[model samples]
Target: MRAGPLCLLLAVMSMATGAHAEESSPLSLSAGPQIIDLQQRLKESEHQRDELSKQLQNADADRESAQLSRLRQENQRLKLQLKEAQATAPQRLLTDQQQWFVTGGGVAMVALLCGIFASGWRRQRRQWLN
Candidate 1:
């Protein structure tokens, strides 16, 4: 009768240990799908990040190009404005040749007037003396 009770106790202890082992270990059937899903999600997120980065770079390049174009246009406009101002401005002072011509003409006129007055004065003096 003691042997029979001991055998029953051993069986009960073995069943309990087996149940504990099963509870402690992970179930492969559920874990496999979960791991695959997590990996797919990670890949998708990385792809999206790469795409966004590329788009940002492209946008920056476009913005810089647009700014460059606008600056070029403004520079061209300024150049045109400068040209127009110069064209519409007044003439500068007389050139060397023109100044020399005016000086020579004035000197000639003064010399001619002096000669005429001197000749007339000499004739009047001679007539008075006679």
Candidate 2:
């Protein structure tokens, strides 16, 4: 009879201690709030990262557009320069041809004048000797 009563008392004491330990532990109470807080922080950081990525993409597009415009302007300027050079090439050829014609005419005139002077001097010398 005393053994049976001691066994019953020990079972009740163990049950009481287990219940007290469960109540004292913080894991049962704070776990939900801490998990929720961490999830919210992660979402906020992801949103911030997306916003920064979008801004960087916009900046890159703007820079590329500016460079494209500059390149187009340079191409147009080069085309105009090429056209001007082509136009001057024909004019330069015409000028060279005119110079050659003028030089040839002057040379022919000088040769004719020299022939006339030589013939007149020979006739005068023959008449004087006779």
Candidate 3:
């Protein structure tokens, strides 16, 4: 019997507090002004971002144009240097030193072959005599 009365009392108290909360909630009057203020701030920030991006793009374009012209001038200079180098240099299959070395090698090979033939002839003659 005591538990039943205590539960009824708690229920009544909860209902009274709920009704009080509905009357005091802040969302009814303050939310509209706060939302408008936040929206205005967001718009201002977005406008600033757009303006900054446009300025950056213009600066980059100027820098790129200058760099492009410098690259072109460097390319032309290198081309002229290459043409001059090609025009002045001689094109040959072999240099003088390489030709001399090849000739010396051929002479040495011929001398070695002649020496072997002469030694073989001498040995054959001695064998026939014995």
| TM-score top scorer | 3
TM-score of 3: 0.57
lDDT of 3 by residue, 24-80 (tens): 977767689989999999999999999999999999999999999999999999999
lDDT of 3 at 61: 100
**How well does each candidate superpose onto the true structure, as a TM-score?**
0.40, 0.47, 0.57
| Residue 70 lDDT, candidate 1, scale 0-100 | 100
lDDT of 2: 0.91
Ranking of candidates on TM-score, top first:
3, 2, 1
Ranked by TM-score, the better of candidates 2 and 3 is 3
Off by over 4 Å in 1: 1-29, 86-130
Candidate 1's TM-score reads 0.40
**Per-candidate local distance difference test:** 0.93, 0.91, 0.94
* Candidate RMSDs in order: 19.9, 19.0, 7.0
